[model samples]
Target: MIETKDKKWSMFGHILMIILSILSLAPFVLLLVSSFTDEATALKNGYSFFPEKLSLEAYRYIAEQWELIGNGYLVSIIVTVVGTLAGVMISAMLAYTLSKHDLPGRSVLMLLLTFTLLFNGGLTSTYIVYTQIFNIKDTIFGLLLPNLLMNAYFVVMLKNYFEHTIPSALLESARIDGATEFQLFYRISIPLSVPMLVTVGMTVALNYWNDWMNGMYYLSANSNIQSIQTILNNINENIRFLQQNNVGTAMTTADLPSATVRMAVAFVGILPMLVFFPVFQKWFVKGATAGAVKE
Candidate 1:
């Protein structure tokens, strides 16, 4: 009787998960279809999974704006790569230090790092500090510096992985054999922490890729230096404002693929992540359980 009940519940859980999966994927399906549907059909019939007429007008419009979009892509890619690499290395190194029980002021440092999660300087102050002190404005550093460099939660997760997942004896043995702290960190901890690193790397990469605020704030004057997200946001805003305010008398709202074109732009923005996810999916699954102690 218990076995039969368990089997029924398992089947129920599977059905529930399948339903959830469909719900999650439904938006992307709509987006994909809407992007391909021409301006007229979408406006009259509304967004649908299957549009009566298919058109590549939205994509063509995006391609025409490729000059801006292309540069934006290059800038975003550079920032994401440089920031992710730097963030991961710094995070791992800091976590390793904090994980060492013998390290002095470790608790205090951890407390400070945790404090950042709860509190931060207001936007105006941050902007002043970056602009006045750091002076990163209108440069490539402006795109790479803000918010993406380090994460406190990532440090804690990595610290836990180091302490709990790795055997202390192995570390002690390495130290006893005269391996420098840097050597152990580079050769031992890093190699063993690939799963966690890749997982954290993905999160870091997404943060950098999707970021536009830094571009908006610091690169405000330099449109050429703006990231893809920043450029897309500008394009969306420009289109909406012109349509609403009737800035151009001859420019008809119905003529532009404002709604459908957004979907095309979004698809292009997220395309890189989609391509790389399958490669990192396995590592992400493993790393989520990185801190669990196996008996």
Candidate 2:
């Protein structure tokens, strides 16, 4: 009787989960369809999974401006790869140090780290610091060195993971064998923390890939260094401004695929992350779940 009851509940759970999954994916499906729909058709119909008219005008616009978009892609890819690798390495090193209980001033150091999450100097001060002090403005380093590079939250999560998940006895044994702290960290701790590394790396990659604010603020005068997000953002803003103030302008609203072009650009912007997530999905999911529960 219990076996039969369990099977019935399991079937119901599967059905519910499938329904929820479809609901979650519906918006993206509509966005993709709208991107393919003709500008006129998209204006006529807001957004739909199945559009009456299909067009390549949006993509054609992208093709015409491929030089700018291509440069954006190159910049974004470089920043994401470099930032993720550097951020993960730096964050892991910091996390490992904080995870050590015997370290002097550990509590005070953690307090300072946690304090940043609760409060921060406002935008004016932050911009001043980065621009005036660091001299990052109008440079590629502006995009890579901003607030997203190393996060306090990542440090805390990873610190907790290292402390609880990694056995203390193993470190003691390695120390007894005359292995240095650096050796233990590089050889043992790093190798053993693959799951957490992948999880954190993916998070960092997503942040860098989706970031436009950093590029917008710091590289305002340097369009050459703008990432895909910043470039696409500028394109969208220009499109909207032209659409709204089409009167007496040299460029006509009808000349642009206003609606579909933005959507297509967004689709292209997120395409890399869509591909990236699936490749690390298994490791990402495992690390997230494992880090939540204590042994």
Candidate 3:
């Protein structure tokens, strides 16, 4: 009787989850449909579940703007790759060190790191330091440095994984076998921590990929350092503003792929994350649950 009741509850939960998933996916599906619809039709109809009129003008306009858009893709890709790798390595190393109970100053360092999560210098101060002190404004470093580096949350997550999942017995045995601290970390701890590392790396990579505020704040179009999201945002804003103001003197209705291009751009922008999720999902789930149950 108890087993039958549990099965019923499980079925109920699965149905609820499927409903929630559809609700979540509805907006993205609508956005895609709207992107392909004619701008006039979309504006008049206020977006439907399906495209009102299939159009390719938006995509063609995007292609013509490739110099900017393509450059943005390149910049974002470089930043995401470099930032994910560097951030994961640095975070893992720091977390591993902090996980060691014998390390002097570990508690102090951990407390200091956690403190930043609760409070931060305001944007004005951060901007001044980066621009005047570090002189990273309008540079590629500006995009990658501010938010892509080591983060408090990732550090804590990694530390938790190390403390709970990695066995102290293994480390001690390796030490007795004449393994150096660096060797133990590199060979043993690193291999064991792959799931957490990949999870943290993917999190950092997604953040870097989706970021555009840093570019807007620290860079100008003339800087030639536009990221993919920034470029897409700029295009969307410009088209909307021009259409609103009836500034169609330079651009013919037929020439612009306003809606279709927007959809195509979105599809392109999201493709990397989509491709990456399936590849990393197993690691992501494992890492997320690694420290949940203490041994």
Candidate 4:
């Protein structure tokens, strides 16, 4: 009887999870379908899982704006790559340093790091500092830096992984064998912390890829270094502005694929992440659970 009850519970759990999985995937499917949906049909009928008339008009519209889109892609790629690499290295190194209990001024450093996590200078102050002191505004660095770089929570996560997951004795043995601190970190700590690092790197990359606030705040709309998200946003805004002002070549706002284009823009924005995130999905899953269990 107990066995039968347990089996029933297991089946129920499986059914629940399957439902949730489908629910999670339904929006992406709808968004993809909507992007290819006919402008008139979509506008009249609203978005549907099975769009009545399929059209490439939305995609064609995007392709028509390919030059700006292409530049946005380039800038996003550069920022994601450089920012992810730099952020990961800095976060990992700092975390590794903090994990060392004997280091001088470690408490003070940790306090400062925690303070940042708790509080930040408001946007106005941050903008002034970056613009006046750092002078990153209107530059590629505008996209690369700002709030996305060097997350304090990520530092704490890495520090925990280094201290809890990595064997301290191994690092000590390397040190005893005359391995420099850098050598110990590079050879011993990093290799063992791959899962955590990959997880942190993925998060940082996503943050960079999806960011548009930095562009809106620091870079002008026409700035060549605007990221893909920023570019898509600009396109969306331009569409809205034109619609509001009744400005178009010949086609009225009513004739425009305004709604479908929004779906298309959203689809375009998330496509790369969808394609690439799954490749690292295993690492993400593993790393997320790595230091959770302490023995």
For 1-295, candidate 4 gives per-residue lDDT tens digits of 9999999999999999999999999999999999999999998899999878999988998999899899899899999999999999989989999999999999999999999998988989999988999999799888877855548999999999899888877778788999999998898788778888898888899999999999999998668888999999988998899889989678788877889999999999999999999888987677556634355
Local lDDT at 209 for model 3: 96
Candidate 3 Cα outliers beyond 4 Å, as residue runs:
252-265, 283-295
| Residue 218 alpha-carbon offset, candidate 1, angstroms | 0.5
Clashes of each: 0, 0, 5, 0
Best by lDDT: 4
Q: Tens digits of per-residue lDDT for model 1 on 119-155? A: 8888999889888899998888887777654488899
Q: Between candidates 1 and 3, which one is better according to TM-score?
A: 1
TM-score of each: 0.90, 0.92, 0.87, 0.91
lDDT-better candidate, 1 vs 3: 1
Runs off by more than 4 Å, candidate 2: 148-150, 247-251, 283-295
Candidate 4: segments with Cα more than 4 A from true spot: 1-10, 283-295
TM-score of 4: 0.91
Number of residue pairs clashing in candidate 2, backbone atoms closer than 3 angstroms, sequence gap of 3 or more or interchain: 0
The total number of steric clashes, by the backbone 3 Å criterion, in model 1 comes to 0
Report, for every candidate in turn, its global Cα lDDT versus the true structure. Answer: 0.85, 0.86, 0.82, 0.89
lDDT of 2: 0.86
- In the predicted model 4, the residue pairs found to clash are none
Better of 2 and 3 by lDDT: 2
